[model samples]
Target: MNENLFAPFITPSIMGITTLPIIIMFPCLILSTPKRWIPNRIQTLQMWLIRLITKQMMTMHNKLGRTWTLMLMSLILFIASTNLLGLLPYSFTPTTQLSMNIGMAIPLWMGTVLMGFRNKPKASLAHFLPQGTPTPLIPMLIIIETISLFIQPLALAVRLTANITAGHLLIHLIGSATLALSSISMTVSSITFMILFLLTILEFAVAMIQAYVFTLLVSLYLHDNS
Candidate 1:
C-alpha cells in the first residue's frame, strides 16, 4: 500500500500536532554523554573523533573561522545521526522534509553571510563583482552574482531534501517489489532481495556523506567570507 510505502517520510503526529521535535532530539539521547574526570571508552572515542573532524574541517580557515568549529561539528553530527536513525523501520527522516531543511539552511547560511559582511564588508561586496570584468558587462555580472549569492541557502536545502527523499523512495520501491516477486519467482525475488541489502548499505554511506557534504559546504562558505 501507499501508506506503507510513504510511511518513512511522513511526519508523525499526536492530537494534530507534529512530533518532529521529538524525532529530531532522539539522536541526542543516543549519543554517549561525557563523564567528568574518568572517561569511558565511548566518551574517549567520541572526543577523539570530534577533535579529528574539527581539526580537519578548520584547516582551511583562519583563527576567526576556527571559532565556528563547535557549531559546524554539532551540525554535522546532528544531521548524520538523524539520517542514520531514519533507516530504522517505521522511522521518519526529517532531512527529507524540505521545510525542515530550509529552516536549518537559511539561518546558518545567513549567519555566515552576515558574519562576512560584518567582518569584511569590502571583501563580501567584492564577491558580487569579480576583478577584470569588462566595463560593459559589470552590471550584468553583478546582477547574476547577486542572485547566485542569495540562492545558496535554497540550494543547500533542496539538495539535502532531494537526496534523502530519493534514496528512501528507491528503497521503498525495491522492498515492495522484492516482497511481491516472492510469490512469483523465487530466484528473481532472492536476487532482488540481495540488491535491496546492498542498496541499504549504500544508503547508509550516502547518509553520512550527505551530512559531511552539507557541513563541508557551510565551512567553505565560512572560509570564503572569513
Candidate 2:
C-alpha cells in the first residue's frame, strides 16, 4: 500500500527506457502544424496564449533582452505542460525531481550570468558591492552578495521540486484515505472524496502558477543582466 501510494513520484521506465523525454516532448506536439492559412480553434487559442505570455514576459525587458522571447516562451510552455500532464492518472511528474530541476536551472541561470560578465563585466562585478557601502562592511557585503548570487539557481530548483512534491504527496495521502474509509463509512468517505476533488482543482492552478513564477523569475534575471 505504501509503495503504491508513493509510486506516482517514481520516474517510470520500461525495459530500461525512461519516459521523461517522452513526457517532455508531449507538450510540443500540440503546437505542430500542417500549413493551414487559417488556424482552427485549438491552434488559434494556442497562438493567443503564446502571444500573451510573450508580451507579458517581455514587458520589463529591454531591446537586447527581447532576443530571449522564444527561449523564455518555450520554457514556460514546456513547464506548464509538464506540470499539467503530471496530474493525469498513472502519469509521472518530472518537475518533482530535484536533479532534473537543478539540471535545468543551473545551465540557464549560468548562461545569464555569463552573458552579463561577457557584455558588461564592470557592471556585473559592481553588483557585488552597492554604491556608498560602508568601508568596514564592504568585504562582508561582497561575500554575502556572492553567496546570494550562487543561491539563486539552487533556490529555483528546490522551490519547484518541493512545491510539486508536496502537492502530489498530499493528493496521494488524501486519496488513499478516501479509499480506505469508503469501506467503513460512506459519509466520511464521501466528504474525503470531495476534499480530494477540490484539492485536485487547486493543484491544477498551482501547476500553472508555479510554471509562470519560474519563467517570470528567469525573465527578471535576464532583464537585470541585459
What are the per-residue Cα lDDT tens digits for candidate 1 across 1-226?
2456666677899999999999999998999986588889988998898888888889999999989998999999999999999998978889999999999889989999999999999999999999999999999999999999999999999999889889999999999899999999999999999999999999999999999999999999999988
Residue 193: error of model 1 in Å?
0.6
The number of the candidate with the highest lDDT is 1
The TM-scores of all predictions, comma-separated, are 0.95, 0.95
Model 2 agreement with the true structure over 89-113: per-residue lDDT tens digits: 8888889989999998998899889
In each prediction, how many residue pairs overlap at the backbone (N, C-alpha, C within less than 3 A)?
A: 0, 0
Give the distance in Å from residue 212's predicted Cα in candidate 2 to where it truly belongs: 0.4
lDDT accuracy of residue 69 in candidate 1 = 91
Worst 10 residues of 2 by lDDT: 1-10
